[model samples]
Target: MSVENKKLPQSYYVPAQSPWPIVGAIALFFIAVGSGLTIMQLNNSNVSGVFLLVIGLAILFVMLFSWFKDVITESNNGLYSTQMDVSFKQAMLWFIFSEVMFFLVFFGALFYTRNLSVPWLGGASNNVMTQQILWPDFQSFWPLLKTPAGDTTQAMGWQGLPLINTLILITSSVTLHIAENAMKVNNRRKLQTFIGLTVVLGGCFLTLQVQEYIHAYTELGLTLQSGVYGNTFYLLTGFHGLHVTLGLILLVIVYARILRGHFNDQQHFALQAGSWYWHFVDVVWLCLFFLVYVF
Candidate 1:
């Protein structure tokens, strides 16, 4: 009953050994090294590190493209099996778990800043000059507005662009659900429509996010260098944006495979993985909207 049971003598489905994954690992190594050196050089006045970082990132992208192309080709050739499906599902689940841990680091930083760092700065402990030296008028609140460095910024409320983006992302998750359900029922037209709509909605959410960033940086004068608040804000939200971009790319690939008559009703691991990623992104955005913007 399995796809592999219908195959030929060999039990190998996509038995090809890919060199690109190893190349990608190498590329990431260079990128990490280059980035570390670049940051060090910024303070030490050394310029060589940035060059390495750029080269590493370039190689990494190339490796990723080549590797993804190979997988796509193998998948289209009907070389995947139920075992492959389980593997993909496990991979995606672990991937999302890793992402959750990544965000937890930022959330930990936020908690430290709010509950400890800011309080210490305000002379909560035995240090009297802490208040005299810095943040004399600082009030410690959950959604930080006045930074310890005396840089003031208006906290982004949840009612405007943030709310709209939240709704858009939630709607996208729903549309992706519809697409997955359509795939289950073997409705290619409905699948394509829902998937395409979800992609468009994702694009719109990203565009709005860009606009919000522009407003924050330019209009509101709240930049990454503003203070600790800006640093955490940008780090969390910017990384989320990058994930959304990757999720959209995955959705596009699934849509392309659908059009090529791939991913039958009984076996569509690619679509399922992409849907999981999209939903993960959406849930992260929801947390960000409440914690970062609304508090």
Candidate 2:
């Protein structure tokens, strides 16, 4: 039930056609244009790339805040019913499914590079002539530290910050679960405490991630320029970091709503959806840690 107090209505409620969709589309357009220009500006001296990017980001922020406000208002006003609740659940599930596919593409790239391309280049099968002509001295390894172009870099290990961050994320999942349980029992204090802990844990993960990046760039000489190894490494972990950041933002919003008592056990889809997204993020990280870091 989307609204706890409202009696279930037979007629489905449809929101009026709103400006948010168009506003979101406009914001995406600007962001797309800005991203392209910014990438192009990397070579040339174009300044509008960054300017448009900032404007797009601002519009996006406004849209998210206002759109969420509208939704929350509608929800609290008992304008929603079970139909609306089902729609929200389906929407969230599909959104997460799309995100999974997005990451799947990256993981596929990693697989193709490591399992097929690298091995074939290293004279696997009868491709000895191919290796001889292409990269005669290339020593095929999982990390591929030394590139055929003679650029060398160190692989990031699963020790220290990476390991600690992995533990932090796992613990966050536990805390979020406890928070959900507390909410179910109407234990506001426990709910707030655990959810707040989840937020702090998320922040700590991001902080450590930044530090890890710094160490990679400054000390390890691992960067985007270090051939396919660096490219895949950064692409996988960097995008995962971005997802984590987004998940943290969601958690913060849910926490704020919880503080306002916007959610009781019956009317907590927002928190439930937020938790679902966060858990999905955690699963992605686990895959990244094992496949990208441990192995």
Candidate 3:
């Protein structure tokens, strides 16, 4: 936008043309292509997907940094009025709402399969004829490990890594809150320490999640192709993990800004935004722990 001071505005702030939007769009394209290729790599030994995925992620990281830097620069330049703050907050809320809807679709699928489809296939209600004509020996059970073609795979247990990761996420949420409070009080040392702790906890959660995936594939016979159960489980947990990764990056950048004294207690919207996102991630994980894992 205009490189002017944050002065009184007679109207709402209208930003000047920015290339960041196009740059972000390009990053998203690379990510989509890379993700499709990586999924294809499960069957074929194509390493190009991994290469593309890394490049896409790198570009995405840079794009986010540059875009945020521009906005923060504008804010510091006093170009943002109260109206701009409200707009920022409204946009963030809408973005989070969109994320909620995205996950709701997946969760709805899980509910449909577990509560309806499985039983229908097992001869529940009017599906008696379906069972007899399909597989008379079919048993309706959670996980549905045995495919119709007789491919047998084991179900993942909720007891080990899943439980540990849940606890880690909850703890990280607490630490983030503490850091937020510390920032509000201008306790830089406390804020930095707790933020560091939260980031470490996030890293640990990701590492353990990777280990869990490895265990699932190596020992539990679980994979994306396992069945409906596997599909829901991986899709839910995998997307949540990706969100956590993004939040971790957000916190890292916020930490850097904090160290540079870019925010005061009264005007730390960036920190607030990051904290809001991380808390949302934590809540999503709690849902997954119960609905996707334990339940």
Ranking by TM-score: 3, 2, 1
lDDT of 2: 0.91
lDDT by residue for model 2 (1-295), tens: 4688887656577888889889999998998899778756866787899999889888988998889989989999998988889999999999999999999999999999999999999999798998999999877789988866687899999999999999999999999999999989999999999999999999999999999999998999898777898989888998899789878888898999988878998889988998999999999999999999998
Among these predictions, the greatest TM-score belongs to 3
Location of the lowest summed lDDT over 10 successive residues in candidate 3: 1-10
Residue 135 Cα positional deviation in candidate 2, in Å, after optimal superposition: 1.5
Residues 1-295, candidate 1: write the lDDT tens digits. Answer: 9987795653447565778878988888887899778755755667789888889888977886777788878877878776777777898899999999998888888878878887887678865587777756766555566655566786666788889999999999999999999999999999999999999999998999999999897777677666777778888888899899889988988888888888888888889889999999999998888878877
- How many clashing residue pairs appear in each of the predictions shown? 0, 0, 2
- Which candidate achieves the best lDDT against the true structure? 2
Against the correct fold, how does model 1 do in TM-score? 0.83
Write candidate 3's Cα lDDT for 1-295 as tens digits. Answer: 5658666555666778988888888888888898888877888888888888888888888889888888888888888777777888899889899999998898899999999989999999799999999889899999789877778898788899999999999999999999999989989899989999999999999999999999999998888878787878889999999999999999998988888878888888888899999999999999989998887
Q: Against the hidden true structure, what lDDT does model 3 obtain? A: 0.89
TM-score of each: 0.83, 0.90, 0.92
**lDDT on C-alpha atoms for all candidate structures:** 0.83, 0.91, 0.89
Stretches > 4 Å off in candidate 2: 1-9, 29-52
The alpha-carbon deviation from the true structure for residue 3 of candidate 2, after best TM-score superposition, in angstroms, is 26
